[model samples]
Target: MMNFHFIWPLSGGLLIGLSAGLYLLLNGRIAGISGLTASALGWTSGGVSILGLGFIGGVLAGAAAVFALLGHAGLTITSSPILLVVGGLLVGFGTRLGSGCTSGHGVCGLARLSPRSMVATMTFMIVAAITVYVTRHLVGGF
Candidate 1:
């Protein structure tokens, strides 16, 4: 049997929701990491580019702080460098093609009850499940 730790997951979810809500309330932003990353890279055309960069910086800093405090015991990635790069590229492409990433569609969009987001989220979930099944069962497994 698998042991489930509920407190950490719940805490993480609450933090995510709170941050997304605050971002939306304060800056009228969706807190989508992919969109913000594009904007930070100067690919997005608008006045929010600077804010996007700041947000990205904040994300990095937060991650660094967490690692520094927590010591990264179970957070190590064993994937090959090439696989990681390819996976990142694929995810970026998918985010662009889908018009939004999970954070935007799954979290923020669902919160607002958007039909488009509902469809997108459903598609994302289905595809993710398929990918996991294929990778874990058909392939050697991740």
Candidate 2:
């Protein structure tokens, strides 16, 4: 029998992929969350993309809906506040340096067969594995 634990995540992944695919197909834009955020924040020369704002709003709404429905019963934050802040900062820096986030590179870029996205995604995965190993074994506190 199949494990029920995977069903929710599988459904979420399908929804994400469908959204990204539709966004790309309709808008002719890559659904890179970082880029969208930057554009929405008016950091880009384009001066506040409406599409970016809409995408961000949709993501937030979806997350809110999920939380409302699920009520955070199984949710837990094991990391300290400082750790989480630092991790968020690092992720922001990494996303900027990488030119895109996982959604853009791993999902959309891979679907489009982009070489840069491919490399970025591989690097992200490798670095994540190394970080996990170090934190869990070498560092001993994470």
Candidate 3:
């Protein structure tokens, strides 16, 4: 018998990796969500990439499909609106500062064996662990 707990996450990871790989192979672009988003919004020099818009649309569509199927039963956000906003702002700033997000560095960059991505991913993991510990143990909340 197999433990079912890991199956869903494992499957999701495989799907993400496959999609990223396929997107790169087909488009000659790294599927970095932050960069794609910036390009789609015309923040980048190209004045809006169709491919970036398509990628964003696909992601939203996929999320909508999942919500339609699952009905948001297991989804919960315990954070306050202010905290969420602050977090979002921080993430955006960090993405700009780091030149990429986790999807870019962790998945695509790591796949390409980028040294910068390696260091970035390690920093991300360590910071994440520290954040989790502080929030769970020190600050005390889910």
Candidate 4:
């Protein structure tokens, strides 16, 4: 069976919630990574908001720090570069089409008890389950 490590996961979840709450409290903004990234990249109307750029930088720095401290042995991608690129493009498109990413709907919106977020989160979970089933069972995932 799978080994369950509750402490790390719980800590991570708490950190995420705390960070999101802090962002909202400080900036009056929802901590959605996709929106922040888009704004940082100058794709949004404001054209590279400093707030978004700072948040993205913090995210990257935090990830690098974690990787440096813990060492991620399983971080290598098994799929082809083309597949990875395509997957990323698809995810970006899907996030735009959906008006928000999983973090936005699942974390912030759900926390606020939003009906639209409830529907979006359910859709995200269902689609993820279907994708996993198809990849693992039907196509044999890499």
Q: Pick the candidate with the highest TM-score.
A: 2
lDDT for each residue of candidate 3 in 29-106, tens digit (9 for 90 to 100): 889999999999999999998989998998899778877877884677898898889889988998899989999999
Better of 1 and 2 by lDDT: 2
Task: Rate residue 52 of model 2 by lDDT.
Answer: 88
User: Stretches of candidate 2 above 4 Å error?
Assistant: 1-3
TM-score of 4: 0.88
What is the Cα-based lDDT of residue 48 in candidate 1? 53
TM-score winner between candidates 2 and 4: 2
lDDT of 3 at 14: 89
Clash pairs detected, candidate 1: none
Candidate 2, residues 1-142: lDDT per residue as tens digits?
A: 8669888799899989999999899989898889999998999999999988998999899898878888885777898999999999999999999989999999999999999999999999999999999998999967
Q: How does candidate 4 score on lDDT?
A: 0.88
Per residue, candidate 4 scores C-alpha lDDT tens digits across 1-142 of 9867677668778988998999889989889999999999999999988989998998889778778878884366688788789879988888898899988889999999999989999998998899889878999985
Off by over 4 Å in 1: 1-7
Which structure is stronger by lDDT: 1 or 4?
4
Model 1: how far residue 73 lies from native, Å? 4.7
Highest lDDT scorer? 2
Quote model 2's TM-score.
0.92
Clashes of 3: 0
